[model samples]
Target: MSTFAKAGFKSANYNSFRPHYPPSFYKILTEYIGKEAGKTGDKVGKTIDLGCGTGVATYPLLQFSQNVVGLDLSPPMIETANSLKAAKLKELGIQDESRIEFGVCAVEDFDAPPNSYDLITAAECIHWFKDYPKFFEAAAKHLKPNGVLAYWFYVDPVVVNFEGPHNEKLLAIETMRRAQQIYLLYVYEDPKGLGVHWDRPGRDILRNLLREVDAQIPQDLFKDVKTQKYVPSVDGLLQLTPQDLRLVREKITLKDFTNYISTYSLFHNYSESTGAGAEFLEKMIQEFETELGWDREKTLLDLNWTSGYTFMRKSGE
Candidate 1:
């Protein structure tokens, strides 16, 4: 997360390339919160989104809550998010631009009155948070009884299928295998790759789909806990989660896919260290094209990330 705070980091590129959560997932979340709200005869009121980089996931919360606050440690990210406030409100046809706000603050340091918020969410950012017990304790303290706590993430996407000259599903499986190999070679396995540049425990926690964080959720502090994962497969078989919870599934050009790779914090660190960032990414794109027999510009890849989410409510006293 410190990498995102550097002066040289490109918040705009991070905004442009990163995958936003699907409305469908929000539907699932809001429905859960809605059911809880019914118990108290209260409408969804306020939300605070932690580590809300560039306001991607933060903006969408406006649809469910009357007020939303997005917080991040990176000044640049908060600046970028604040700059887009009016525009996002306009896009949402929201009359009160003040309904949304962005601030520069670490998630752990963010303080609010007890029982102040109806919902608290962390999107693709909670893994970077230290001290899960303290964090969850803070969340439970700040949330109204029965208020919701949710966090979700999307990990490396795999080429599940493609539209190309070779249309066979078997070819798709092979392409996925080769793509995984390329990812490992460039992102992890190679000495010259970005492996050494990654921030630890955070990266490891994310790559494992937040299983560690989920385990430490402190069942006593929260109730009605639910967690789900959508795993991508190289073998030819149907793999699906609930349709509404399918957070990241898209068809994008290989070039666009590589652009997404450029937004990685580890890639930025590697580029700074080696000064061959662009060249290295191009090589990765080329290797994918050459090994998979797909053109970077023309092939449309059906990409599915290994994504998961956990939703729970603050336990009653």
Candidate 2:
């Protein structure tokens, strides 16, 4: 398993930059569980969110489950998730302080009683697991009858088009695409003789999470499998000109953008190994800015992204 143990990686920055799963995504999850429960009236009793980074997916889960546990292998991530749990509970006016809990441990090492969880979710980090088949087998053992095992992951963002002068719009779109490519090259290619290969086997499993799961899960262990894509409406502020639709844009300074990139585990590893990872990141940023003609003091990128989910219930009436 790839170590996400880099000391310089910041969970806060990860929380800030990672695109969140849409509300509809969670709604679909709850509705599916409700439908599966049917007349038995079994609401979700408990949930465990694997790799719940900073509680991004865990907090929203509280609406459907009575108790939630956020687990991760990284202590920093678990610490941030616990902190967020406290802040979010207060913000939502939820007084049941025990509703959410967090722990630092690998999925393989974590244990629960048989038939303990009503739901289990892994958000974006399942690929990192060294033994997913074993993980699924363990999950099957822990899930209650008609319980769910759901997971979702988003692909690299795509720059469809930008709103600007007709001519400049095309150029802007291409520039954005090029900039993303450059960033990815630095992360995945390690072109600078850094002896770092940032890409991992886990990354290869992302595009086919369900496929991988299907291959690993015992046929009789799960059923009613479903998959769906979620494309949220882009933010209006990102449009250079008034239009019916545009891509989502979080107004981030160049520094913030670079910090976001630094949150990538591979980047952290590369930096630690070479001691020049920060320098390389600066070089990437400079090239990206030059490509976009960006003024560091007053430029923001409209990041475009979409996500998908796969859900299935434990086999039982």
Candidate 2 pairs with clashing backbones: none
User: What digit string (tens of lDDT, one per residue) describes model 2 on residues 1-317?
Assistant: 44564455678878887766655566677777874322234447899999887888888787777789998888888888877866798865668989889988888898988999999999888777778668878888899988999987775554443432222443554666565676567655556733254556676676444457556766688888876654433332232222111224455555566676676676667777778877876787677566666654466555655456778899976
Alpha carbon deviation, residue 311, candidate 1 (Å): 0.8
**RMSD after Cα superposition, model 1:** 2.8
Q: What is the C-alpha RMSD of each candidate to the true structure, in Å?
A: 2.8, 5.3
Model 2 misplacement above 4 A:
35-43, 161-170, 193-195, 207-210, 229-254
Local distance difference test values of all predictions, in order: 0.84, 0.69
Compose the digit string of candidate 1's lDDT tens values, residues 1-317: 69999888899999988888877788788788873321333447889999999999999888878789999999989999988888888888788887888889998798999999989999999999999999999999999999999999998877777776442444566767877888878888898888899999899999998999999988888999988887877552547756434644466888888888889899889888899999998898888776777678888877777888999999996
Q: Which ten residues in a row have the lowest lDDT in candidate 2?
A: 238-247
